[model samples]
Target: MTMKWKGWALATGALAFSATAMAAPPSAEMISFACAGCHGTNGGSAGLTMPSLASQSKTAIVDAMKKFKSGERPSTVMGRLAKGYTDADFDAMATFFSKQKFHPTTQAVNAAKVKKGEALQEANCSRCHLEDGKEGKDDTPVMASQWLPYLQMQMDLYQSGARKMPEKMAEKVKPLSKEDLDALLHFYASVK
Candidate 1:
């Protein structure tokens, strides 16, 4: 009788656990499907002007979304779109994107600029961006293989004060001539 009772209790416990799990909210992958239209499947952007989200740190994605929601970050569409999501949704989407593989952008670059950009990246940006900008530390987004136009747009925003950047990054970027900026862009796009 004792053995039978133990088996029955185990089965009942398993059933209850399954019920609870089933009752939980939609998963991160499900929530992330909504982002595919603009961000591409699994956070890789196909659009030249849109920044890809794959492999970016979860903190980076969440922070950007939070800023968009709060109007702390300027955007043409993100600000409006961000208003609809709950914190849980933001977290879920971030988690989903952070785990996806980064698909590097394929585009033409000036070989001379690429060489100069590589040197510049090593000297100035590698501390946080690491791996030729293929890797990011903490909240830093990956720079390697990102779209040139998108990068250019972002740099322009940083220069114009339309977007905020970390003080150190701004300091490093502020002094660069336009040619230097172009070289940096070429270098980042060259990273595979």
Candidate 2:
């Protein structure tokens, strides 16, 4: 090839390489490390109040982060933390967390409450929160094997209107008494 043609070819090749590198998505592991401090390594939270993100649905993670970022979701720290991330950042982290396996935390729960909770879950929540609340559908988060305290906190938020609950969920939970709520928590905690 002529020298001038060869130079032009090299320049074009270099430009293409640079564009390819820039177009590549961000590293999921690198971006997700920011979550390890609170959500635990690979999103399996060790803290009782922090819900585990591992094995959560990607859509759920993205929606929650977006709400937190927009201040639509009430939170002490997540809102602040989420504000710093972009849609791409959220997608990367969500993809990483969604792929990790969820390991349930073991806790002692009242058997009686678990029974009532099971019945309540089947009657009211089964349609959406399938797999006995272990698996999530669409934007729903996994409820089974979640931290009991976290579950309680979220329920309290929904009940108090601090966090917006879905219309169906609100209708279902509206008639439930405090005791009934506690029973549901126990039932979720009991699920493996």
Candidate 3:
């Protein structure tokens, strides 16, 4: 090779190496990357039951991970999955997910169910989750447009004591029936 070409190649190689070195290692990123398989790319899930993590509040994600790890929340896999992550990993994953845009899913809903849910929400749920279910506070989560099954399961957990709940929240859930939950789920599923 010409001397000039060799020098150019060497500089390019050095630049590439430095770029790679400056970036965090794959394992550090894997802590968040591991969720893509199930949560979908950037946490926009196509699964009917899988909850979307994209655009979720970072505080909500971190809190949930801590809850799952501490045995304060019930889950089929999240509890076990959370056990593998450290606080830093959880925080990084939360930040990664919170940056993504949240696109609402198209799920069928009944008018009657939505109406009932709207009532329930206006009365109790909206105080914390807001009318659109995005969030009422910084740490609160966006419940709007989440998968119905996942929302229902969480409600079930909260109601059954499988998940810890404050006394005030518990009181509100105490009066809920199956139909009530279904209505609420349908309503939130339909929101943007």
Candidate 4:
């Protein structure tokens, strides 16, 4: 082959290799290192207050990080941490956690409580959290398979006006009755 043709072939091969490298999956070690402090080794969080990241959607995870960076989602610690991440870093982290499988909760939920919870979740949560409470878009956390105690506490915070979220969210939950809260908690706790 002529020199110019050989050069062209080399360039094409290099481009293909670069694309393949970019598409490779992120390493487990990198994911673990980034999440160890709050989410523990297996995606179970260190405390009840922190949400588990395992089994969460890649889209939801990235969206939350974007919200934190933009100051739309209000969390002092998360905002600060998200600010330092580049778009590429956020994508990598989201991809990493989305692949981790979550362990099932062993605690049993009461039947009456579950009935009430289902009603509350259907009325107030379905819009954003989706019918199964597993799919959420644009910075909303998935409630399906989430820790029940953690979910309950967040709801209480929202109801008591202790947790400040987007204005629309506060407005949505403002009218939730006590029965509604109980029902919502039960419904989410029972979801796999």
Each model's lDDT comes to 0.87, 0.88, 0.80, 0.70
lDDT of 1 at 53: 90
What residue runs in model 3 are displaced by over 4 Å at the alpha carbon?
1-30
User: For residue 113, what is the lDDT in candidate 2?
Assistant: 99
The regions of model 2 sitting more than 4 angstroms off are 1-25
Q: After superposition, how far is residue 189 of candidate 3 from its true place, in Å?
A: 0.9
In the range 1-192, model 2's lDDT, one tens digit per residue, is: 356855675777864655553454559888998898998988888798999898889999999999999998899999999988899999999999989997688987899999999999999989998898888657999888788899999988988889999898889988999999999999998898
Per-prediction RMSD in angstroms?
5.2, 5.2, 4.9, 6.7
Per-residue accuracy of model 1 over 50-145 as CA lDDT, tens digit each: 888999889889999999999988899999999999999999999999899987888889999999989988888889888998876688988998
Q: In candidate 2, which residue pairs clash?
A: none
What would the per-residue lDDT of candidate 3 be over residues 1-192, giving only the tens digit for each residue? 356855675777854655554454455346777898998888888887788888888888999899889878777788999998889888889888888888578777788999999889888777777756865246677788888877887777776777777676677777888898789888998888
What would the TM-score be for candidate 1 when compared with the true structure?
0.86
